[model samples]
Every structure is written in C-alpha cells, then in structure tokens.
Target: HRATFTFDLTGMASKTTNSRGMLPDMRSNLYAAVLAGLAYPGINGHPLTEAYGVRQRFIAIVTDLELPNDPLTVLSTCDECDRVCLRACPTRALAGEMKQLTIENTSIPFPLFDTFACDWAKRYSLNAQEGPQYWGVDESYPVPENRTAEEVVKAVTRTDWGVQKLHLNVAEECLRVCPARGTR
Candidate 1:
C-alpha cells in the first residue's frame, strides 16, 4: 500500500518559509489539491494559495501498490459567481476584471488582483467601511487608508501576533467573502 504525509505549513517559522511565507521547495499545491480535496481558482488562474487558507506540505512513499490519481480541480464556482470578492474588498484590491495567461498554447482566465493594496489593507487597518470587522486586533493600531504599506507592516509586525511570528493581522476580507469557504 502507498502512504502519504501532509504537513500544514501555516505558522511555520520564517527561516523555513520562502519569500511567500511557505516552506521552500515543497510542492504543496499538488498534494494540497489531492489531500485536502478543496482548491479554487487563484491569481492568474493558479490554484488558490492554499486549500481553504491552510497551507500544506506533503511527503509520499512509493510502494508496490499504486493509488488512484485525484480528479482535477475545476473553477466552476468562481466563474459563475457574482464576484463578491471584488466588491467586498475595502481597498478595491481585486478588480472584477479577467486577465489571460497562456500556458502550453492554452489561455486561462484569472482575476486581476492588487497585492500591494491587499497588503496595505491587511497590515494597517480594520477597514470598517466596506470590509468585515476585525474585532480581534487592538484599536490602537494605525488606520490603513491613511498609512503607507511600509508603515502598516511596521505597526502589525510589532504586535504580539505579527505576520512574521504568528501570521496574524487584519482579517482577510476577500478570502472570507468567498462562499465556497463556508460550504467547505
């Protein structure tokens, strides 16, 4: 029989984390899709950063027995939706626009995302206007709209739960707006 081991990389130390805050050299994508059984379309038609926001690392043992391959993830859900993420973003980070990426002579449709704006929102403010309420963060933190990205990062990093140490910050409103997350 074949065996597989999967490790959730969330909250992993920065030393082991790559620039993306994920464990270096781990093909978590393939294993996350296979094991978690939940993946949605992400930026540039790629799989979502993690299956349900839980990053994973995997190790598999090649054995005499072969296991069936998992079914490929489909992007039907996001494609058919009303684009809540785009509208819900307080910083307007996700424009309701489709971008094309060509791979192996095939074109794929993905959302137009603004990472800098997203980072600004997550690091700086609670975004009480259009975004979800982040009740967990202390009220003393600087408001995001008035601050720069660098300032926001500095403020959050100094907290007891920074992205560096605990990976905590303002709630991810875009990810939370997705309906699939709730059903899953």
Candidate 2:
C-alpha cells in the first residue's frame, strides 16, 4: 500500500503540472499515462479522496492543520515564489493563512485545507473555457455562468465542508495546484 502511494507521488511530481510552459523533456517528463485514473472528467473538480489510507474527502484539504507550516503566519514569500497555483481561484478559495484553530459550526472552513471546492471550481472554470480538453477528474455540474456566485456559495455550505469541531485543510490549495506532481 505504501509503495502504491509512493508511486503516485513520484509520477505526480514529475509530469502533472507545468503552467510555466517549460519545454517538455523526457528527462523531466512526468505525467499520467492515462493510467492513474483520470481524477477529473469534464466538469467541476475533485477534492482529496484519501489520506495515508483514510477516506476523508475534502473540498479544501485538512492534512496541514494537523501539520502546519512553521512560518505560515508571516505571509512571506520566497525568491522563486510561484503563487499562481495558490492564486488560481478567482473566488479566493485557496487563500488562507496557516493556523491550528478557527471558527465553524459543524466543520471549520480552512482555505488551505479545502482544495476540493477551489479545485473543483478551477477545473470547472477551465472546462467552461476549454470544453473538456483537460478533464482531470470526471465530475459534472450545471454550467457556472448560469448561476451567481452567491448561489454557488450556497451550494458549498458547512455540511459540504465536513462534520467536526474543527476542520484541517492546509494542503488542499497547494496540493490542488497540480500538487500530486511534486514540484521539488
């Protein structure tokens, strides 16, 4: 089981994401060979489906609150900062600061943790633009243009966030930024 997970990470790190439009090289080539189960299909997007083996799906993701960034509070950036993946959402879905606590009714809505919503929305937006050229995960949704942001917001209430005293979704955004494709 661990080996299977490791393989997924290895493949994801090499080929899945390259928005910088770098020339493809076999030496640095890493992409799904149409074998890693298309995570997106035609519309919407995908959230986290598993964690270390647990079936805890997330719109955002919560693996990080369990293990937060050491300097997450500073809002600092590095020399080679490519926050495009972090800033990909037009709705500001993935923007969040790292912390261990927050407020919520049933499930806390952590931007970092909740990649499913933003990821789904990102893919959905891309689908609307490209018409299914890159359906990474196979899901469906009514056309987003037909609805208002508030309506879409209504669709993702706390229940969809999850059920718990608090939620943990740190990696969802960074993770969804072609995260399976490890950058480093």
lDDT of 2 by residue, 1-184 (tens): 1122222322322212224332221111111311122121101122221121111221212132343222112111211346454565434444544332231222222223243344334333322222222323222344344455565554444112223343221222333343333122
What TM-score does each of the candidates earn?
Answer: 0.48, 0.25
Candidate 1 residue 173 Cα shift, in angstroms, is 1.0
Off by over 4 Å in 1: 1-40, 43-72, 125-133, 136-169, 182-184
Candidate 2, overall lDDT?
Answer: 0.28
By TM-score, who's the top model here? Answer: 1
Q: After superposition, how far is residue 169 of candidate 2 from its true place, in Å?
A: 23
Error of 1 at 102 (Å): 2.4
Off by over 4 Å in 2: 1-81, 101-180
Our model 1 lands, by Cα RMSD against the true structure, at 8.1
Worst 10 residues of 2 by lDDT: 34-43
Write model 1 residue lDDT over 56-99, tens digit each, in one string.
23434445675676544445656556767667777776776776
Best-fitting candidate, scored by lDDT: 1
lDDT of every predicted structure (CA atoms): 0.45, 0.28
